[model samples]
Target: MFTFLMMLLLFVPIGITVDLAEKVGKMLENDVPFGEIAFYYLDFTVYFANLLFPLFLFLSVIWFTSKLANNTEIVAFLSSGVSFSRFLRPYMIGASIVAGFALFLGMYLAPIASQGFNEFKFKYLKKNKSVQQTKDVYQQINDHDYIYVSNFIPKTKSGLNFTYEHFEGNELKYKIFADRISYVEKDSAYKLTTYLKRSFDNGIETVEKETQKTVQFPFELEDLTPVEYAAETKSYGELLDFIAAEKRRGSPNIGRYEVVKLKKWSLPVSIFILTIIAVAVSSIKRRGGMGVNLAFGIAIAMIYVFFDKVFGVMAEQSNFPAIVAVWFPNVIFGILAIYLLQNAKR
Candidate 1:
C-alpha cells in the first residue's frame, strides 16, 4: 500500500502536468475560467489514476520485492522454514486491500470522473459536437412505438428525416413523418418541420399535415441522440439500469455498455493477478539486479494492457461478448501467473 501510494503520487502529477500543458492553449482560446480549468484537472487526475491502477500495483510489487531479493531478505525468510505459499500470504492480503479500493474507484468514483472529464472536453476543447453524435439512429420508444432519424446533431438537439410509427398487433396503426425535428429542452417539446401524420382505423385512413408543429413526445432529447460516452457517465447501479432500459428499447450500444460494466469488476480482479505475477517475477535476485526484474515487469504490463485494449475494441466493434472480452486478458495472465509462481517455487 505504501508503494502503491508512492507510485500514484509520483505518476499522477506528471500525467496531469503533461495533460494540462497540452490543453492549455485550447483552454486559453476558449477563454475558460481558471476555476473550471482547475476542476477539470482534478477530474483528469482521478481518471488517470484509475486508468493506470493495475500498472501501479504491478510496479509497486516489483519494486519492493526486487529490493528484498537484492538484500537477501527473501532468502533469509525462506531459509527460516517458511514455505513459498506461506511467504505469499502477506502479498495476498495487501493485494486484497488494493483490490477493494480499486473496486470502489471503478464502480463509483471513476464514472463520475469520466463524466466530468468527457464533459469538459466536449464543452471546451471540442468545437464541433457532431464528432460525438451518432447518425442514422433507430430506437424503439415503446412496445408499439418506434422512431428513426437519418442524421442527428446532439448539440443542437435536432435531426433530419425523422419518422415515428405506431403499430397495433403487427399492423401499422399510425405514422408521423417530418423533414426536420428539433427538441426544445426548456419546453420539453419538439418542433417538427413539414410534419405529416397518417392514421388508419378499420381500413379507413385519416391524414393530417402542418408546415411546422410543436408537440410533446414520450422521450427526451438524449433518447433521440445519445452521446457516444453515455455509458461512461453512469455509475454501476445507474449503468445496470441504463443497460436494462437500453435492452428493452433495443439500443445498438448495448455491447459498449456491457463492456463498461464488465470492466469494472475485471479491473479489480486484475490487481491480484498482476500482484502475483510481479512477486513471482521479482522474488529472485538476478545478475542484472532490479533492472532486469523491472524490464520484465514492464513488458508483462504492456502485454496485459494490449490484450485488454484489443479485446475491448473487438467487443465494441463486433459480436464478441463483453464479459469474455473483458476477462480474456485476466485468464491468459492468470495462467502465466501460476506458471511463474511454480517456477519461482522450484
Candidate 2:
C-alpha cells in the first residue's frame, strides 16, 4: 500500500506538471476562466492516472517484493514450509480487491473524467483542431441510405456540400443535395441551404429545387462525424448502446469503439497478470539487490506497453478482432507470469 501510494504520488504529479506546462499558454491565450481550468485539471488527474494504472501497480508490486528478497524475508518464508503457491494467496487476494476498484474506475469514473478532459482540451487548448473528421466525411446511414459531407465543423454542428442518397435495391430511388447544412437545435431538424432533390420513378426522373429548406433525416448531425473518441466520453452502458447504434449505421469506427469498450474490462484482468509477474520477478534475490529487480520490471513494463499499442492500432485501423487485440497482452503476460513463478518456485 505504501509503495502503491508512492507510485501514485510519483506519476500523478509528474504528469500534471508536464501537462500544465504545455497547456498553460493555451489557457492564457484563450482567456479560459479560473474555475473551468481547475475542473479541467481535476478531470485530468483521473484521466491521466487511469491510463497508467497498470504500470504503477506493476512497479509497486516489484518494489514491495524486491524489498522482501533483499531482506531475506522470502527465504525465511520458504524455509518455514510455506509453499510457493501459498505465499501467493495474499497477493492474489490483494490484486482482486485492487482489480475491483480498477473496474469501477474504468467503467464509471473514467468516462466522466475523460469527457471533461477531452472537452476542455478541444474547447481551449486545441482550437485549431477538432475531435471529429473535418473533411470528406461520408457514411452509409442504413441499409438503403447513404450520406456525404465534403467537410464538417463539429463545434458549429454544420457541414458543407452535403448529399443524401436512398436506394431501392441496387437502383437509386432519390438523392438530395445541399450547398450547406446545419442542425437546428430549437426545431430539432436540419436546415439546408440551396436544397435540391431528384427522384426516379419507373423510367422518369423529377427534380425539385428550393433556396432554403428545413428537413428531417433518420440520423443526427453528430452521427455524421467521427465518434471513436466519443466512446470514452460515455459510461459503460452508454458506450455499449452507442456502439450498437453506430454498427447499424455501418460505421467504420465500430472496431475502435469496441476496442475502447473491451479495454475497460481488460484492465482488471491485467492487474492480476501483472501482479503475478511482479512477484515472480522480484521475489528472487540478486547481487544488485532491489535495483536489479526494479530495472528488469521496468523493462518488462515497457515491452508490455509496446505490445499493447501495436495491437490497439491494429484493431482500430484494420479488421483485426478487437477482443483479441485487447486481451492478447494479458494472455501473453499471463503465460510469462506462470513461467517466472515456476522458476521462482525452484
Candidate 3:
C-alpha cells in the first residue's frame, strides 16, 4: 500500500497537469464553468486510478519485498525454518484484498467516471461535428427487422437516407424509406420527411408516399446512433444487458463490448498473477541490491503491458476472440511466475 500510494502521488500531479493543459484552452474559449471543470478532474482521477491499478500493485509488491531481501529479513526467516510457500501466503492474501477492491471499482465506480470523462470530452473538447456519430450504419433491430442510415447526427437527433426493412421467412413483407428522419425526444416519435412505404403481398406491391409524417417507432434514438464509447459508460449489469441487446440487434461492435466485459474480470485476475511474479522476482537479494530488482520489475511490467495492448488491439480490430485476448497475458505471466517461484525456492 505504501508503494502504491507513493506511485499514485507521483502520477496524479502529472496526470492533472497534462489533462488541464490539454483542455484549458478549449474550456476557456467555450466559457465552461469552473464547477464542471472540477467535476471532470474528479472523473479523470477515478479513470486513471483504475487504469494504473495493476501496475501499482506489481510495483508495490516488488519494492517492499526487495527491501526485505536486501536487509537479510528473508534470509533470517528462511533460516528460522519458514518455508518459501509459507512466505507467499501473506502476499496472496494482500493480493486478494487488492483484487476485490479493483473488482468493485471496475464493476461500479469506473463506469460512472468513464461516462463523465467521455461526456466532457465530446461536449467541450471535440470540435469536429462528424466525430459525434458515425456515417452509414446498418443494424438489425430484431430477427426480422433491419434498419439502415446514410448518416446520423446525435445533436439534432436526426439522420438522412433512412431505410427500414421487414422480412418474413425469406420474403420482404414491408419497407420504409425516408429522405430524412428526426427523433422528437419529448414526444417519443419520429418525424420522417419525404417518406415512402411499400407493402408486398404474394408478389404484389403497393406504394405510398408522404411529404412529411410523424410516427412512433419501437426503437430509441440511441438504437439508431453509433456510440464509440458505449461499453465504457455502462455499469456491470448494464453492460451485460447492453451486450445482449446489441446481439439481438446484430450490431457490428459486439467484439468491442465483449472485450470490455472480459477485461473487468481479467484485470483483477492479473493482480494475483503479477503479485506472484513480483514476489518471486524480488524476494532474492541481488548483487546490486534494490536497483536490480526495480529494474527487472519495471521491465517485466512493461512486457506484460505490451502483451496486453497488442492482444487488446487484435480483439478490437480483428476476428480474435475477446476472452482469449484478455486472458492471454495473464496466462503467459502466470507460467513465468511459477517458473520464477521454483527457481527462487531452489
The CA lDDT of each predicted structure is 0.90, 0.90, 0.89
User: Against the true structure, candidate 3 has what lDDT?
Assistant: 0.89
Residues 149-242, model 3: lDDT tens digits: 8988877888899999999989999999999999987899999999999999988999999999998877877788757788988899999999
The list of candidate 3 runs beyond 4 A from truth reads 129-133, 184-187
Clashes of 2: 0
Q: Which candidate is the best by lDDT?
A: 1
**Count of backbone clashes for each model?**
0, 0, 0
Which stretches of model 2 miss by more than 4 angstroms?
142-144, 155-157, 167-172, 184-188, 202-204, 226-228
Ranking, lDDT, top scorer first: 1, 2, 3
Weakest 10 consecutive residues of candidate 3 by summed lDDT: 127-136
Model 2 agreement with the true structure over 189-305: per-residue lDDT tens digits: 999999999999997999999999999998876778864489998889999988887787777788899999999999988989999999999999999998999999999999999
lDDT of 2: 0.90
Better of 2 and 3 by lDDT: 2
Candidate 1 residue lDDT tens string, 1-346: 8988999999998998898889889999999999888888889988878878889999999999999999999999999999999999999999998888888988889889998898899899987755444578888887888899999877677899999999988999999999999998789999999999999999999999999999898887777777788898788999999999888777888888899999889988899999999999999999999999999999999999999999999998788999999999999999999999999998
